[model samples]
Target chain A: MIVKSDEKYSTLGSLESELAISGLKSGSNLEKLLKAGYFVVTAELGPPRGADRTVIEKKATLLKGYADAFNITDCQTAVVRLSSITGGAILVGLGLEPIIQMTCRDRNRIAIQSDLLGAAALGIKNLLCLTGDHQKFGDHPGAKGVFDIDSLQLLQIVKGMRDEKKFQSGEEIEVEPRFFIGAAENPFADPFTYRAFRLAKKIRAGADFIQTQIIFNVDKFSAWMERVRALGLHKKVFILAGVAPIKSLLMAKYMKTHVPGMDIPDEIIKRMEKAKKGSAKTEGLNICLDVIEKVRKIEGVSGVHIMAIEWEEAIPEIAKRAGLLPRPSP
Target chain B: MIVADIKPFKEIMRLVKNYRKICVIGCGTCVTVCHAGGQKQVSEVAAQLRLAAKLEKKHLEVGEETILRQCEHEFIDSLEGLVQKYDAIVSLGCGIGVQMLAERFPHTRILPGLNTKFMGAPTEPGIFWERCVGCGNCILAETGGFCPVTRCAKGLLNGPCGGSQNGLCEVSPDTPCVWQLIYEQLEAQGMLDTMEAITPPKDWSVGQGGCGPRRLVLEHLVEEEKDKHKIAEKVLTRNDCKK
Candidate 1:
């Protein structure tokens, strides 16, 4: 195909087509690290609920060299916040690679495709597909959920757009949105035995990477990983186990009791409660470090995705204490 | 079967406040099985309305009648004479029956005394649960005879969503997650491979969202009627020749 740089539309189309065919060479640093067989470390930045660019920038700066790439959550828990794309763009400007999380709860197929194109156009490389928390849990319970497609379908759609160079309708795209596809796994959720099988299904659907829900019960997670290993899914996709540092005893108790799908053992909660007032955060970090060390040793486990949540400042220290820092240079 | 529940007595009373004479109609089919709008329930509602009106010092005449099926025109036609005598008709049948009565007795004001829940069978003697939304296109064959559209809280085609825990739905710990049941059933049938296939988005046009007041016409039946007309004409011609 003859490409022209001066033609307004053709230039953009050819540029994207070049990137798409080259296996998305300009992909995120996480993709590079995973490809290079580096023990990767990722973190998350929950974009502020309001229009605060500095919040995202500060978090990005804090996590700059501590982690490979951090994810910008798409309205986590269905509570509306800064758009992941915008937050991701800001992180890119701040020299931090971002994995833009996209949820199926708020957008239909058209919006999802449009946002993918827009995100790719703005230099966003990583995409994490999720079936977001139900709207009933969010501030807008009255809002209609447009799960036009679920996470599995979302993964398939992104894969098609990137690999097949076509839309979900099978129409050819001049410029495909090449992304490093990722999907979420909840091992602690339900029918615990089926969780690994479900992860296999996600991988089959074209998820290049997997990030799980926060792990407080490592034994159960290991059982799930065993199933994943039995299927040899670890060889097909990178599995990043999720860990979140509990800031206080109250937070641990809340996650254990209030959060659905979260299985925090009573022993961990008791340990948190026993900690002295000033040392609770330290105890939480220690527990997180322990989980990280243990998870790193598990076969088929690639890395850890530390979700510091609102406590972004603790991520650097956590990564340092956990011996994950001095991130590998590309 | 369409399961229903009786509307609050106060609501029914308020609906028929202006009418002095009311005819309460019931269906003997699905509603009867559900104990909602059966012959027995019709009498119960009539008695309640009568007592309630008497207590309020209002003269009210509540007549009770039960039909074999309110959905069929023949059974509903039986109430032609009795229906006109009443100022209003209180239908203890499902929503379909209430609408059928309204179409049959255009002059009588029809009020629904029961809330039509869903097309479902009773799990036990008294407790009822929804099993179908009548989306028109059924995929029970693929889902191990379990209807994810009706059972899953999100109506997910490829489920169970993350909310499923210990085979129970996150919406309610009491409610068993239908997808989990489907997975187990499919596994038991040695059909776990079926769950691996991603179900495409449903064709809503064939479902409730497509259009309004859907009807099915049998073309062969119409063709048969035409054939009967031709046969009748030939018989008449032969009879004329004899004459």
Candidate 2:
């Protein structure tokens, strides 16, 4: 196959043919890290709302080598964005591993299965199954939501495709997708007592790694981890503590007041507001480092997932400060 | 029960503007009980149409009628004689009632005066909550009798989607998360073990998924009528043979 000088494959057909010969193994590097007993680090990469390739390419350049893998978000917050498959393909072309996030909000089973096959064909190894944010919170509120299968069902379907070499309908696949499946859990959400049980349910649904919602309340997260340990679930899957840096006082207040499933403590808000005039960003970074340090010491925590949102530049410093630098090669 | 809300008066007036004579028909069952479209509402709509037409100096004829049940043929048969008296009909019944009126009086125009909301029941004096989606397959046995198919915004069957906070849905503070409710109910009953099992993907074909309209026929009733027809045919054949 003759490759382009620019390395930008225009069509998926060509990409598929090229990947077949590239000898890129169909498994996640993050999985390898977890198995090797390395404290892994991952971060989120939100796709642009429009067809702009440079937006992700630029962020990928900054995020490369700072984390084991990047989670390419699929229409995060229910707003329309570049498809996760396309974004993951772009990251793959740039030689970065992407854990493509699949949501149950916009596609039915048929579409979901087709996209899974495509993601596999594009050399995506990691898959995160999310029920996604409700469409009411996003730009298109009038759109019809297609939650044909929730996240648990999605995990089962992916697991069936991978392990059984069969589709959701029990039909055989010519070549099954090999994905290190992941699922999200929230410990701060209401009915907190049931949170660990839900995590156990995700593990049963074939979640290889568990990424939790961003944590600001360390005491609550520690308690949740305690429940997880009580159930003996830590042995089953890798648990990554999700943490995000608050860039400003406004973002902190908004996340506390507006965002659902987030627990922002009053002290964190007070700390953010009291940051020295020109050094709030540094304070936010410090707060994030503190969280990583705290969660890293927790018994069951296997890694930390830093979601810097639009502040990708802060990841390298955060990772270095937290002693997670020199990302290991799998 | 089916819940419906009347369309705005301006929209109703616009729909009936071209017709010189119109009749406002209301349902006496579901819509009546819901206070959306009943005898009282029909009279009020008719009077409002008259007053608006008079103010506009437009000559118009308006009539009012309330049927016991617009969905049933027997209840709406009383309007047979009055069907030709009006140019158009504005039905204040649920979607099924409007369709029934349209199906019965094929030649006349049947316009809906209310927007059919959902299959629900009154939660309070003025609030109604959707309870069932008629998904054909019921998993309430496993879910502690709470219908997540209808009450949940995403219709998630496995568990709450990590968005429930303080027992309320993430979509709205006023909307209680059905999964949280289910969890609490099951926990109280000491049945939390039931929720641990993963619910498989729903069989959507049982509902009106890819299939068209659904129909239920009582096979025994149909067989009884067929038996009578067979007897009549046998007697006719004997008479023909004798001739």
Q: Give lDDT tens digits, candidate 2, residues B113-208.
A: 999988889988988888988888888899999999888999999888778998899998899999999999999999999889999999888775
Chain B fold agreement for model 1, TM-score = 0.92
User: Model 2 — TM-score against the truth?
Assistant: 0.94
**Model 2 per-residue lDDT tens digits across residues A6-90:** 2231111222332223333345788766665667889999899899999999998988998999999999999999999999999
* Model 1 lDDT on a 0 to 1 scale: 0.85
- Candidate 1, residues A75-112, lDDT tens digits: the string is 98889999999999998888888999999889988899
Q: For candidate 2, what is the DockQ-based docking class?
A: medium
Give candidate 1 regions above 4 Å deviation.
Answer: A1-22, A48-65, A89-95, A142-144, A326-330, B211-213, B225-243
Q: What's the lDDT for residue B91 in model 2?
A: 96
Candidate 1 chain B least-lDDT 10 residues? B201-210
Q: Looking at the true structure's interface, with contacts defined as alpha carbon pairs within 8 Å between chains A and B, what fraction does model 1 recover?
A: 0.41
lDDT score, candidate 1, position B243: 100
Worst lDDT 10-window in candidate 1 chain A: A2-11
Instruction: Give the clashing residue pairs of candidate 2, or none.
Output: none
